[model samples]
Target chain A: MKFGIGMFGDSGYDTKTNRFRDPEKRLKEIVEEVIQADTLGIDLFAMGEHHREDYVVSSPETMLAALSTVTKNIILSSGVNVISSADPVKLFQDYAMIDLLSGQRAEIMAGRGSFIESFPLFGQNLNDYNELFAEKLNLLLRLNKEEKINWKGTFRAPLKDQTIFPRPKREIPVWIAVGGTPTSVLRAAQLGLPIMFAIIGGNPRQFLPLVDYYKEQYALAGHAKDKMEIGVHAHTYIGDSRQAVLKAYYPAYSFQMNRIGKERGWSGSFTQSQFEAGMSMQGALYMGSAEEVTEKLINTIELFGLTRYIAHI
Target chain B: MKFGIGMFGDSGYDTKTNRFRDPEKRLKEIVEEVIQADTLGIDLFAMGEHHREDYVVSSPETMLAALSTVTKNIILSSGVNVISSADPVKLFQDYAMIDLLSGQRAEIMAGRGSFIESFPLFGQNLNDYNELFAEKLNLLLRLNKEEKINWKGTFRAPLKDQTIFPRPKREIPVWIAVGGTPTSVLRAAQLGLPIMFAIIGGNPRQFLPLVDYYKEQYALAGHAKDKMEIGVHAHTYIGDSRQAVLKAYYPAYSFQMNRIGKERGWSGSFTQSQFEAGMSMQGALYMGSAEEVTEKLINTIELFGLTRYIAHI
Candidate 1:
């Protein structure tokens, strides 16, 4: 199984200042973490885009470009590029540069980002979020396939058969990252794109229907079953013991979630019951000992036959 | 004086096939070339942006990002980011990323590009050429100063106290590149931006008036002479002998210049007399042996009191 790590560049809450620490220092830690992961034989590493003050990475490709230099072998990508707020041509150029630097180890995971801050930040309308994402994804995919693009779209300027320069030596894999929505799964499958199912909460088994639907859609879309791919991303952290892992991760996790919760109008308060349940067998969280995590991974792989598994910490 | 090398990432024309080479291969050569330049103790290295097929880079920051990994100690910069055709926020993000990756070895040379192809490629109009550049440059300067900007402009969407993330750790020096234009020089001087004068053609003495005008304007604008800076970029090639250098670079240089010349209604043909004249003392082109080149650079530096000298090969 392909295994990887994901970072959001979030400086976990500082108790003294009661705010995140310097993002620059946190970004440095990420570079060190990636170097360590590469040495440890990790298959890939991805970073997510977040626009709020809590997250340092508003541009994932920027972080990837930094990581591309210090890490070797580990495929570099955006856990999700938050393509909904970005221009596809620019995204292609940025990641293509990373691919070249990493010797073709770059991939782009496009998503209608979980966060909405980028919408207003880039002067995008919240009403058009879904449409904006679909349109941009279409544009992003077309760019990877063709260098000289002649296209018109509503949300972005037209490409008048203009060529995008410095194309990568190999085609970059552009994956679609999806949540619990069947429509998102079906859309990815229909496009013959790989899907990275983000199961950050609840039971992993609950996503079985969406996975099954995606495969069915893949077949209907005439994609070869052998070539189709599925990846899993979850809230994960490993420690010597289950209690130790929870103790170390919960405070920060609760802080971040509550911080995000304030913005989205949801109660981000954490309870021990929810945490314990999420860490149990078949649960969404991967917080546990090596054996417990391994067994959980095995069970999930057997359930969905995942091609790749990524844990976010 | 700060001495550096400049690469345009131009694909040399193939005599047999009569076509430019693969840009991917050319880009790889650029990487190796920068590594060698770094080892040779070059102080800075700059890459130019072009949208046409003959040139590989449309995004200089992308190339700089790739180079940031393989080389050290060289200050990375764009020969000029065609700010007229770019989003200033995006340009800031890309270069900031480069700065982070390179540990503060990053700069930006902003220019109303000598070539106009990018203006059209990025959905801009030639009619608004000067205005577009000035407006975008104002925004770019604002970005460098403030983390959260409330900027409103004609060409771009309004930024309502929006934050541009991943600001560089240190101040990123932004230099203005000019091609002997009185207005451009005066603007650079008035804005207190350093100037990178491109002396690609004609007698070097011809630019003296414009340079002097800049200094007078800079003083009137209240910028201290000691604090102000200037740089020069010229067509250059080095070899064992002047004869070898000319014969080696002439074919490709003429082809590119003429190709560009044809579009601008000028005769692209080169004669031995003009070539010889251009390589002499007080000439523009810097094609010669180590001693000859050094003498030329020293003469020019003495003539203009140049702070930096970059040779475009």
Candidate 2:
């Protein structure tokens, strides 16, 4: 099974000064941390795409392209493509460029991004979210496979004999990031694409049934079971002890969860018990020492027979 | 004055081996080369965005993001942005992300790309190129200045009080890449933007007059002369001997020029004399040792009073 690390590119807060240092310096530090992770036998390094203050990465492809030069073996992937709001042609061209720069190490996970801010910022409609994703995803899939494509969609202009250049060394690997959406899972299966489960909260094993559903649906769609790669994404940290891990991660984690929870209408304070539960739960939060992380990952890998494991380390 | 190195991220052709290595390896090498150049006092390391196989960089932002981690103290800039075909919001967001990744080293040069392939591929109209660039550029400029903006245009939907997030550490510097168009020059002046002259194959001094034109226009437009920095972009290389440099660069240069020339109806069987002329000609190719290149750059700097010099190394 392949293992990957994800970065939100968060700069740790300096409580003493109570002010963030230069963001560029913080960003460079975050990238170097990822590079360090890449050297530690990590198979992939995925960066989240966010248009928020806390999260630094808005162009994951650009970060991946830069990472392509620094690391030797890690496959550079984008955590989300924001398909509903982004132009498919530009995404294809950008990732293809990433493939060219990285020697085919570029992989993209497409979904309707979790953040709604991108919609208005990009002059897109939240009302057409489903339709926009459907149309754009179809076009993106078509562009990924064909060198020259003729595609017309409501969201964008039509292409007549249009060829997107600088094709990948081979077909770029694409995954559909589904956040507990059965229809999205089915769509991915129907399209013969891999599914990346965004299991940010709850137990990891809770997703087993969904994994089963994907496999059955994929098999029903005539795709071999072995051909499908079941993957999971979750927040993580590694430290000397459980206390150390929580001490390092809790404030940021609580801040993010609370901020997102407020927006999503979830009311709950992040507690120590929940953090402990999440760490020890039969799920994919690989947070602990190297051994602890390895143990948790091995268990999850064994449980799901996962082909890829992505952790926000 | 600042000096920058640009790489095409060229993918090599193999005649003997039918199998080919991907450009990712070459890109890694190029990053190392840029780091070396940075150590050697190169001010900026820029990569162009191209979608053709002959050129490898599909997303210069991604490459720059990776470079952000590995190198120190070098400005990371995109060689050009295809403003006419790209979504400006995404463009700004991506560059903002690069800024976060590279510690405010990110800068972009916006242009109406030399190639027309991006138009059809992105489902945009070739006829509406001017309007598209105008609207997008206007939006981008607004986005750059404000955290939240209300924008509406013909090309895309309306944005109602939207703010792009992950704001840069500082104001992201942008330059207009103009190919000697009077209107383009005026646009830069009126917008109070810096202008980069894409002088590929002409007398450098000829553009000196255009530089004067820009200065006069900027003053006429009620802008300070120092607010607008004039830069020159030209192909370059440094090798052991003139003969060696010519032999190495000619084949690739001829192949690229002729490919574009065919579409544009320019005739040329590049010869040794023309190559020599380009080397000797003021404001032409920069092919020589470090001292040779430095001398040539100093001459151009003195002759044109250029504030920035971008070498397509």
Candidate 3:
């Protein structure tokens, strides 16, 4: 099993005011953290892409490229590459370039990014969300496997015998980042792509059934059972004590959760009990000392038979 | 005056020959070199975006984000963002995000990238090349200054009061990259934008007149003299000995120059005299000991009265 840390490059927000530090300074600290992780034997370090002010990484590929120069041995991946909002060809080219810099250590997880800001900002329609992902995903998959792709899609222009440059030495590994969508899960399984289950909240046991469903679908699609690997994405922090972890992480996590909840029509406040419940329950928040995290991770892996675990630290 | 270094992240044809280290390992060394430069008081570090297999950094922003986390105080900038091949909205969002990560120290140089692969790969037309850059440049400018933009163009769909998120704390610095095109120079001056001169080969004195032309155009465009900064982008290296610098750089340099020459109807096989001319003549290549580079830079600055000297080391 592989363990990786994912950061949105969030510098953490001041809870009372919901404000962030100077982004430049915060980002510098984030890069330092990645270097520290690499030295600590962390297997992978991933950054998420966000177009909102609270999240600092809008160009994950570029950030990865810069990181390539600084760190060694750690696999570099993206928590999400907002596929529905970006050009698939450019994404392919960008990742390929990163692969070259990082020596084929580049990987990406594609999804419809968590926010709606990308739609209007990129002149994309939210109504065609499903079709957009579908068409773009097909194109992205084609670009990933073939050097010369002849593709036509409704969301973008058509390509006739187009070959992207800086092709990876080998096939670049790709995973689908799905946030609780059965249809998306089925789609990933049907395509025989690895699944990264983004379990931000709720019990981890609940996701076991989804994992089972994915395996069944993969089997139905005639893919080998041994070919699939299920992974979990969780929010985490490791400190000397649980109190230290909570004190350092909860305010920012609550603020961000509430901000997202306000947009998605969920309850906004993070009650003390609810926070404790989330920490204690078999859910995705992997916070505490390193020992506690390792134990919980092992348990979760056993429960879901997950081969990989990614934490948004 | 600032000293920086640029490298084609990929080793290209030398991959099988053991002439260059693998991309990942080489990048780790490069990052260490940049850190060393930072400590040595180098002012800026820029990475170019290239789609060809030989040149590796297709996603400069991703790499920068990773660098933002590790380094301190040095200015982080992209050598070039291919505005012609990339979506302006996405480009703006990515850079703005970089600003957030880098504490508002992020800047970008926009250009119609040197390579042609991006054209067909991204489904853009070579016929509308000028129009693509013009519109994209205009859009990029607007997106940089304003939070909400309502724009329509032939290259992209119409936006109705669209706002790009993750806005920078201040107006993100932008420069137009030019490769000796009078129209490009005029366009940048007309827009009150700074110019990044790509001085690949030839005498630096030849570009002095073009610098004068830009200042003249800026005055004609009704902009203040203090508003424009001319940055020279050149291939560079610093070593303990002049002989050592040549020994390490010449083979890779010749390899790249020959490849480019092949497509442009130039002859194969780079000669030692040509390399010597570029190094000794006041041209683009900045190769030699640190003292040699610093002296040349000061001389160039005094002669040109330039604001920034971006060395492509």
Candidate 4:
């Protein structure tokens, strides 16, 4: 099984200043972090996009390109590229260049982002959210496969025999990232693409039905069963002891959860009970000592028949 | 005076296969070259954008981002980001991230690119070329200065109280690159922006009048004289001896010139006499022994009182 690490590059909260830490310092730390991960033989590193003061990176591809020259062996990917609000032509070309720079170690994980800031920021309308993703994803897939393309789409300017340059040595890997959406799962299955489920809260086993559905639909769609790949991404933190990790991770974790929950109008603050429950064997949060986390990971891997597991730290 | 080097990252012609050299090899070589330049204490390195098979880099910012981590001291910049067809918001954010990554060493040299490939590739109309550059430049400058912006333009969606994130540590230097266009020079002067003249062809002294015009206009516009900056970018090659350089560089140089000449419908083949003239003191080409090129560079710098000179090799 493939194991990977993921980061949103959040600017750390500094209680002394009562504000976010400097993004530059955080970005430098991320470079060092990835280099260390590569040295430790991590399988992949996925960076997520966030256009905000709290996050250091808005362009995952840029961060990936920066790491391409410094690291070896680890796959560089966007955790979710927010393709709905992105220009696919530009996105494909950028990643294509990264692929060449990294010796074919680049992948793209496409998702309708969990955040809405990118919509108006990139001049995309919220009303066309679903349609925008579907259309742009179609364009992105076509750009990967075709040399010269003649295409028409509602959201973007029409292409009349256009070709993107610096083609990849091989077709770059494209994975679908879903958040408990069956239609999204059906789409990936129908297209025979690998799927990554974001199981950030609640019991990890709850996603088994969706995983089973994906497998059934994938087989019914005439895709090879052995070729199907399934993966899960969850909030994770590890330390020498459960108490030590909790002491180090809980304050920041709860603060972030409450901050986002407040933004989304979710009821109540994040409590110790919720955190404790999430740290359990069936829980989604992959936290605790190395031995405990390893056992949980093995169980989850077997439960989902996962080909990949990403610890979102 | 500040000195810099520039490259278009041309995939060299392979005489044996009669094909372009592999771009992957060229890209890796570029990273090594920049590292060497940085080690040698070059003031800056500028990478140009090209959307074609012969050039390896289509995104200059990507290349700059890659170099930012590996190199120290050398300023990383887009030699001439084709900003006319580019999204200014995206451009600013990308460079802002690069600036933070490099401790404020990132810069942008904006230009309406010499080639037209990006126009159609990015779905921009050639008729709106000049206007597009004007509008985008205005937006880019504002993004550098303002924390909150409200802007409306013909080519892009209006920004309503928008604030781009991951702000730069300082106003990232913005320079205008002109191909001997008086109005373009006047605009840069009027805006109090540094201007870079691309003196790639003809006698180098021929640009004296235009340089004088810029100095006059810059003063007339009431910008600080001491703060004024002017730079020149020229086609350059340096070697141990003229004969050694000629023997090695002539075939490939003539091939590229003839190939582009064919595309632009320019008459006649590139001849040896023309190459010899270009290598002379009066020529724009900076090809010769290190002493000869240094003397020529000093002369050109004094002739225009250049604050900076970029050898586009």
Ranking by lDDT: 4, 1, 2, 3
For residues B1-313, write the lDDT of model 1, one tens digit per residue. Answer: 8999997888777869987787666777788899899999999999998877678787888788777766879989899889998888778877776787677888999989888877656678889989998999998898888888889989888888887666677768999999988999999999999999999888887888888888899999999889888889998877788898788876777667777778888864666767778888767889888789888888888878799999998
Per-residue lDDT for A45-108 in model 3, tens only?
8888877667666777867766776778889998888889888887887787678667778998
Return the TM-score for each candidate structure. Answer: 0.96, 0.88, 0.83, 0.98
Q: Report model 1's TM-score to 2 decimal places.
A: 0.96
Model 1 residue B226 distance off true place after TM-score fit, in angstroms: 2.2
Judging by lDDT against the true structure, name the best candidate: 4
How well does candidate 1 reproduce the true complex, by DockQ? 0.50
Question: Which lDDT tens digits does candidate 4 get at residues A52-160?
Answer: 8778898988899999999999999999899998999889989989998999999999999998788877888999988998999999999999999888999888888
Candidate lDDT scores, in order, read: 0.84, 0.79, 0.78, 0.91
TM-score of chain A of each: 0.97, 0.93, 0.94, 0.98
Model 3, runs deviating above 4 Å: A7-18, A39-42, A66-70, A160-163, A201-203, A235-256, A267-300, B3-22, B25-33, B69-74, B100-105, B200-209, B234-258, B266-303, B310-313
Q: Please tell me how candidate 2 rates in CAPRI terms.
A: medium
TM-score of chain B of 4: 0.99
Please rank every candidate by DockQ, starting with the best.
4, 2, 1, 3
Q: How large is the C-alpha RMSD of every model relative to the true structure?
A: 1.9, 3.5, 4.4, 1.1
Instruction: List, residue by residue over A1-313, the lDDT tens digit for candidate 1.
Output: 7998987877566889776676667776787889899999999998988776677777788778767766779999898888888888878877777787677889999889887777876678989988999999998888889878888888888888776766777789999999998889989999999999999888999999999999999999999999899999998888899999878887777766676678778864766777889999957998899999989998898899899999888
